[model samples]
Target: MLVLAVDTATPAVTAGVVRLEGDTPKTLASRITVNARAHAEVLTPHILECLTEAGVVPADLDAVVVGCGPGPFTGLRVGMATAAAFGDALGIPVHGVCSLDAIAVEAALGRDLLVVTDARRREVYWARYSGGVRVQGPEVNKPADLEPTPSQAIAGSAGHVDLFDLPVEPVETPSPAGLVAVAAAALGSGAEPAPLVPLYLRRPDAVAIADRKK
Candidate 1:
């Protein structure tokens, strides 16, 4: 199976093509740009480049996987919308995985881990994983509010990972390989993926005019 995966749940705008056979996923090509504001500009080109480098066209994709973020509204929208559009155009299924799960899947297995990503406003998006499966949160909170044990290794954004004082594994951000790996079961089942809902975790920074009058 050929899969196209994308993630903009962090500053990095990531895209890749992966070929899955049996139980393994092999990355064919990928591109990542670390610009918080360039998700819109960089994502499409990255996708095209990834597909071209992988020697396949969009229509060749068997499925699309996307990071449904606990990230900023604007950046998160870019990835999800692109994935949905691609799936629609190609008439393939689109799957959404928690952005944090993508990071967790890349961690060393059989150990407890804490995955954290920048959520702006002095807060972070975090989850606790045991043996690569999320056992706890995909919640957003102030870093200091979520205490990590000495045994739990850390992964995700460098800035937020540093805040916990735990052993850091330097995951940085979600990758196309990670996104597709974590979504493999769904892809294999041949079921229609659920709706691609953004895991904002908190309300958007902007509010409606009706709420401002209070």
Candidate 2:
């Protein structure tokens, strides 16, 4: 199966083409830009470049796997909207996986772990994982508030990972391989996809003019 995966839930605007066979996923091509403000500008070109490098066209994609973020609203909106547009235009199913879970899947070592991403306002979006499966939360809080144990290891946004004292995994963002791995089951089984929902754990930064007047 051929899958197109993209994630804009972190400072990295990532996109890739992956080929899945049996139980594993192999990335054919990928593009990543680490500018926090470039998702809208770089994402589409990244996807097209990935497909081109993979030697496949959009119609060859069997599915689209997207990182539905617990990220800042604007980034999540860009990623999810692009995934939806691709899925709609190509008539393929689009799967939404938690952006943090994608990082967890990449960092899994069959032990307790933590994944966190920048949520700005000096806060982070975090989740605890047991053997790579989400066992605790996809919650947002100030770094010190959720206190992790010394034995636990962590992965995800580099800026925020330093706040926790646990052992760290250098993986600072979601990879295309990790994104597809999170949705491997559904993609393999050909299950119907659920609604694509963005996990903006907090409200948008933008406020209505009327509400601001209050």
Candidate 3:
């Protein structure tokens, strides 16, 4: 099966094409850009480039996998919208995986992991993984504000762990490969992609004009 996966939940704009056979997934093409603002522009081109490089078109894909992020509202929507649009056009299945889980899956050993992404404003979007599944949360806050719990490994930006000592090595950011794995499982399970939903764990930075007037 051919799958297209994308993630724009953090500073990076990531997209990839994977060919899945039996129980494994192989990367045919992929790209990761760490610029926050380019997500809107880079996402579609990356998808097209990935498909072309893989020598497969959208119609050839069996499904689409997307990172449903607990990320900033604006940037997170770009990836989700793109994935949903492609799925709609191709009439194929699209599945959403936690972006943090995708990052955790990228680490060594596939053990229980705490994944975090910088959310700016001195906070982050975080989650915990266990046995290749999300076991704790997809929450938003400073790492120091998070519950102090033990983990087998850590993923996402290393800055997240600066406030606490952990049992495992810290991995910075979710890799394209990890995002693909999570998406693949969702597809394999016959999960349906809902309307593109931004997993914003917190409110937007902009206050409403009405509220500001108060």
Candidate 4:
């Protein structure tokens, strides 16, 4: 199965072309560019370039996989909207994989691991994965603000984290490869595409501004 995967949950905007056969998922072509403020501009071109490089067209894709982010509302929706538009146009199933799960899978950490990402406003988007199972969070806030709990390690940016106390496994950033891997698992489980909804853990900055203005 040929799959088109996209992610813009963090500063990085990533797109990948993967072939999923029996068990293993192989990457044909992938690209990632970090642009904390360019998600809207860069995401589409990256996706197109990836598909072109892979020598596959959108219509040829058996499925589309998107990172359903617990990221900031504005930055996270670019890819989601693109996924929806493509899925609708191509009439193919588009699946959603948790952005944090992708980061956790990339780390390939132990029985307990925390995946975190910058959420702006001095907050972090965090989730816990244990023994390959997501156990806690997708919590958006300062790391020190999270309830004191111990995990095997932590991955992703730790700016808001209490480094001396939290376990340190640091995955750094999310990648298209990890996102594709999670998408493959979802496909294997017979998960089909649905409306690409933005997994915003909190209201958008725009909404906050509008409320304040009123």
Candidate 5:
């Protein structure tokens, strides 16, 4: 199956065209722009360029996958909205994969691995994975406050990795291929996808002016 995948849960704005057969996903083309502030500016163009490089058009995609993030509200919103627009226009199923899970999929770490990403606010969003399957957390807390676990190593945002004492993996963002790989089963089974929900573990910073005035 041909898939269009995108992620904007971190500083990297990522997009790709992928070919999935069974459980293996092969990326046909990918584009990444490492600009924390460019999610809205770069996502669509990155996606278009990826498709072009892969020699596929929007009509050729069988499904769309996006990272539903435990990330900043604005970044997650841009990615999810763009992906939904594509799925709706093409009449294809849009699958929402956990951004952390996507990072874990590519890490191939052990039962003692943890995944984390910069959640801003002097904190991080984290989850513990047992051989790539999440077993704990998508929770946010300061590095010092995170409950001590048996985590042996960590993989995620490069900026935040050094905050913890574990060995680090090179992955810094959820790649488009990793996003699709997390949804491979649903795509192959032709299951109805769940609705897109941004995993903003906390409320957004923006509030109505009336509320702010109190």
Candidate 6:
């Protein structure tokens, strides 16, 4: 099956085309631009480029996969919204996977691993994984609030990885290949696609103000 995958949960705006044969996902092409503020501007173009590089068209995709983020509100929306739009337009299922899981899926560490991504405001989005499966949080909190096991290794954005004293495995962002690979089982089992929800973890910084007392 031909699948298009995207992830914008970190500074990277990522897109790719993957061929899933049975349980394996092979990345045909991918493009990533690392800029926190360019998600809206760069995502669609990246998607198109990935498709072109993979020698496929939107109509040829059998499914779409996206990273549902525990990330900043603005950046996270771009990926999920774009994936949903493509899925709707092509009449294919859109699968949502945790942005953290994307990174976790690619981790080569042999021990427990912790995945962290910038959440801004001096905080991070984190999860604990063992054997490539998430065993704990996709939660957001200050780095100091997290307790990493003595043997745990870290994978994620550089700055956040520095927050921990552990050995950093250095994974800056989720890859499109990882995003689709992690979702392959669900897709194969015909499980319902994940809801199109942004895992902002916290409310947006901007909020409505009530009218002044009149």
Cα RMSD to the true fold for all candidates: 1.2, 1.2, 2.3, 2.3, 1.1, 1.9
Clashes of 4: 2
- Give the per-residue lDDT digits (tens) of candidate 6, residues 166-195: 888867788877888889998788788867
Provide TM-scores for the models. Answer: 0.96, 0.97, 0.88, 0.89, 0.97, 0.95
Q: What is the lDDT of candidate 6?
A: 0.89
Among residues 3 or more apart in sequence or in different chains, the pairs in candidate 6 whose N, CA or C atoms overlap within 3 Å are none
- lDDT leaderboard ranking: 1, 2, 5, 6, 4, 3
- lDDT (10s digit) by residue, model 4, range 64-161: 88898888877788888888888889988888888988888888866577777888887788887789788887778775676535676777765544
Candidate 5 residue-wise lDDT, 1-214, digit = tens: 9999999888889999999989999999999998889999999999999999999889999999999988999888999999999999999999999999999888887558888899999999999988678899899999889754688888898888888888888877898779988999899999999989899999899988998899
Per-residue lDDT for 17-44 in model 3, tens only?
9887755778899988888889999999
Candidate 1 runs further than 4 Å off:
none
TM-score (C-alpha, index-matched) for candidate 6: 0.95
Clashes of each: 0, 0, 2, 2, 0, 0
Tens-digit per-residue lDDT, 1-214, candidate 2: 9999999998899999999997598999999899989999999999989999999999899999999988888888899999999999999999999988889888867768988898889889999988667987899999889888733798888888888888889888999999999999999898999999888877799989998899
Name the weakest run of 10 consecutive residues (lDDT summed) in model 4: 157-166
Better of 3 and 6 by lDDT: 6
In candidate 2, where is summed lDDT lowest over 10 consecutive residues?
Answer: 143-152
Cα error, candidate 6, residue 68 (Å): 0.5
List the lowest-lDDT window of 10 residues for candidate 3.
Answer: 162-171
Full-model lDDT for every candidate: 0.91, 0.90, 0.79, 0.79, 0.90, 0.89
